[model samples]
Structure formats: structure tokens, C-alpha cells
Target: MATAKDVAARAGTSTAVVSYVFNNGPRGVAPETRERVLRAAAELSYRPNALARALSFGRTLSVGLIVPDIANRFFGELARALEEVAAERGNILLIGDSSQRVEREHEHIAAFVERRVDSVVVVSVSDDPDLSAFADAGIPVVALHPLSESVNASSISIDYRAAAASATRHLLEHGYRSIALFNGPTESAGSRQHRDGFMDAVRDLAPGAAVEEHSTQIARAHAAQVALDMLARPSRPRAVYCATDEQAYGVLFACHRLGLRVPDDVAVTGFDGTEHSAYSYPPLTTVRQPIPEMAERAIALLAAGEERVRETVDFTLAVRESCGRHGTDVAS
Candidate 1:
């Protein structure tokens, strides 16, 4: 309720001096004068107009984040890390969940453009998500997943194919000849990479291995429903390699419902090794994407205001109890 004029009147300084103090100024104020303005503001509980300052400076000091599935633990972790990085640079983060819908994603895109956010980071449901709205609005955008060449945006992620291959090979090494791959909902670039990596690993390591692929929405419940039927069959897979930690958890639930023990009746592996994965029943053998490092890099890149850059972060295969291992050690 207190205005700058009120504080200025109390401080015996002009409103321009208050502006200089609050904005850190186009013109410098003396230390004594600055102290008087601050004291007066504290007495009157004066607040500056952030929107007015942003309008004048052409920066909202906020970052927009769009995630495909907010309920998925992986995305939640990514958002948390991104939020921290954004906050460190004095930027508030605005999150939009698309729920794996392109229309929802586009709505968020349009909203971010309209808000005039300083930058945007997205994990789109589509490989070639149309970001022209943000592009036309001159807002720099980055994708956390691989994007098609036509998308016109920067991307930073682990090599999905390589990460998938690495996890699949680990399952193969444990001698899982009859394996199944649980993938994301569609045949997007990321899903294809996962499928390719899975098949490639099977071909190279276990040429005669039996393999099948199943697609489901990137959620625990949907994946569980699909797995419950497949896992109940007489010729169920000896092991399952999931494209996400969420799906892997679903398969674990299915196995539990069927009274099958993990790494004994069947082995399992997952991608996106979220922190909670470590506490799963048998623990989770997974590929750990560096969410914090990737988030830091993405935020820093946008803050740098340079040409958008394409970069690949590293991933590790975290060996744990979910997949049968040779030793008691549980580490990458």
C-alpha cells in the first residue's frame, strides 16, 4: 500500500532518488542517501513496481518451462532442477504441463509467447513441436529432448539411442534372451531411437534373442495396465527394458500382482534414474540422465544470450538390484 512518493517524502529525498536506489540506477546515488531511502522504505513498507521495471528493461526476469508429463517422476525432478537453476539467476520459473498432447503444448507455447518470458525450456510431446510462435516473438527456446531439423530450436540431452543401448546391453549381459521393450506412446524420434538402440543391442549381443516392443502413454498406470496382460502370458519375457522409470515401476507392479519375483522370475531395467528409483522394492537398474547438470547448462546457455547451441549431456547405467548383477555393489 505504501508508494515511492510516500517513502521519498519520509526520507526527505526526491522520488527520482528512490528510483535510483531501487533500480540500481542509470545514475548512482550516494551511500548515505541510499541508506536513508532504504530506512524510509522499511518504515513505510514500500514496494516497487516490478512490471513497470520489466517493461522499461524489456525483460520479465522469468523463464517458462514446459514438460510433457508433470506426474512422471523424471519430469518432476527435471522441473525441480530447472527451477533451482532459474532461481539462482534471479528468474522465476513458470511451468506448463502438456500431458503428452500437441494441442496442449501449443497452447502453452502461445501463452509463453504472450507472457513475453525471457526464455523457454521445453520437453515437448512431438519431435518437431512447432515453436514458431516463440520464434516469431523473438523468445529464445530450448528443447530438453531431441528435435527434428525443422523445429528451429536449441536442444540439450543425453544421447537417447546410446543411453538405451547401454541399458539394453546390460540386460543382455545378465543373459536375458527373451526381452521386451516398453516404450513411450508414439513413434517419435526419441521413441525410434529407443527402439533402434534396443534392437541394435539385442542384435549385437544376443543375435538369437527374442524381442518385442509395446507402446503406452508415459505414465505408471497406463503402462501397468498393458504390462499386466503381457506379463500374465505363458511366454512372458525373461526381462523387460523400459524407456522410462515410470514404465519400469508399472512393470514391477504387474510382476508383484502376478506374484513373480524381480531378477528371479524376470529382470527389469529403466531409463531416467530418478532419486526415488533407488528406493523401489528391488531397487531399479537404470540409466541416470544428469538432470542437474543439463538444467544448469540449459539455463546458462539462455542467459548467455548467444546463438543457441546443441549439446549432449552424459548418462550412466546405474547397476542395482532390479536387474540381476554379479556382485553386491549397487552403483554405475
Candidate 2:
């Protein structure tokens, strides 16, 4: 609870001198004076008022991050990476979990704009999220998903279509013709990209392949229930490609409940290769999204300025126990 005045009083200096010393300021303080102020601050355990400073400078020195689900491991890891990167660049990260609600996401947008965060990084619950709040407030934003060209915001993401193709091709090359796609609950731009990529792979590989598709919420529980119903069908897919690692885990659980063994019975591939994916009952075969790199680039773009950048990072197919290493020997 030590204030600048307390530190200044202890250091035998004016509050302005203390402020100058703390902020490294508009006016220079003598080295000896600075040393005394530092010693006094240390003695009193003084901390500068961040809000006051932000008010003075017209910047909060913070970035706002909005994700649909923070409980999901992918977003959790991304938030951690972005926090680290922001700290490295002398800024703080404010995380907002929309919990898959458009209203909640809009609430976060308004909140961040009201607080005057330097910039924002968004992974919207809806593909066509209204970013006009940030735009109207002149707050720069970068979306971490595939956004439509009409939205006035920067974006950075991997090619979901290509990544989807890679996962599907792995199954096809392994001779699993009856493949299925377990996609997100809604037909979003992101989901569409995934679907398009999946269909592209299936069609290119097998001229007349019949692929089944199912949609569910990204949560493991919802996906689990959905998978349980689907996998019980007599004509269930030979291999299933999931839109997310969370959904894949649900399918894995469903297979277990139905007394089915992975690869031997039903092959599974997941997208968003989060770290925990490797620790699944049978390590997952997935498309490894470059999370850390994506976080870094997104933060960098926001920090540098919002210049309407569109970028695609690389994605790799991580073949492991779940998908069964069939035709290819690649692993990660």
C-alpha cells in the first residue's frame, strides 16, 4: 500500500522526482537521486499505479484476447504463449472466454474497448463476429481463425482446408475408404473451410468416395455423446477425422465405452494438436497447428500495428497410435 508520496518522503525527494525516476521520464533525475528513489521504493515495497499511468499516457499497455473456450487445451496453451510474448514486450494480456456465446463475446469486445487496451486478439465463437465495436473505438484487432474478406480485421491462421486434407489423406492412404468428418456444431467460415478441405481430400483420393459428416459442440462431453450414437451404427466409418483434439478425445472415449479398439477397429485423426493430445490413451494422430508460432505472430502484428495482415502458418500431420501408422512412417 505504499504510494509515490511515501517513497518520495522516505527518499527525501519531491513526488515529481519519484514519478520521473519510476517512469524513466520526461525529465531526468540525477543517478544518485534515482538510486535513492529505488532504495526507498524497495524499502517501502512500493508499486506504481498502473491505471493512473495508463490514464496519463492514453494506453493501458495491455492486450485483450477473446477465445470461445479457454477450458479447451488449445486455447489455454495459446493464451499462455501470448501472455509470455506480451510480457516479453512489456505488456500484459487480458483474457476473455466467450464460452461459445455471441453476446458474451460482444461483452468482451465492449469491455476491452472501454478499458482502452492497446490491441486485441480474437478467436470468435461465430465466424462472422461483429468486430465493429473495436473498430469504432479505433482498437486494432487480429483474429486467429479464418475470417471472411469482408470483415475489417487482420487474421493469422493455418490453411484449415489443407490441414483437413492431410488428415483425410492419411486415412485414405491407409486404405480406409469409409471415412467420416466430425466437425464443429455450426456451419461457420472456419467449419466450412474444414469441411471443404475434408471433401477435397476425399474426392481427390477416391473419385467416388462417400464420406459421412456429423456436427457437434466442441466440448468433449457433447462430442462423446454424439460419437457414442454414431459409432454404434452398424455402418459406422472405418476412420473418422475430428475437427478438434477435444472432439477426438470424446470419440476415443466413445470407442472405449463401445469396446472398440483404435486403429484396429476405428481409426481417428484430430486437428489442433495440443500438447495433451500426445498424452491421450493412445496418442492422437492429428494436424499439429503451430500454436506458439501463431500466438507470437498474432501478438507481433497487433503490437506493430493493425495493417490488415493475412497470414498462413504451416500445419503438420502428426501420425500416432490413434490413426495407426499405416502407409506413412512419419511421426511427431
The whole-model lDDT of each prediction reads: 0.89, 0.88
Position 249, candidate 2: lDDT: 96
Residue range 196-232, candidate 1, lDDT tens digits:
8998899899999999999988888888999999999
TM-score of each model, in listed order? 0.95, 0.94
Where in model 2 is the C-alpha error above 4 Å? 326-332
TM-score for candidate 2: 0.94
Clashes of 1: 0
For candidate 1, what's the RMSD?
A: 1.8
- Candidate 1 has what TM-score? 0.95
**Residue 14, model 1: Cα distance from true site in angstroms:** 3.0
The lDDT, on a scale of 0 to 1, for candidate 1 is 0.89
Expressed as tens digits, the lDDT of each residue in 227-289 for candidate 2 is: 899899999888999999999999999999999999899999998989998899899988888
Worst 10-residue lDDT window for candidate 2 reads 323-332
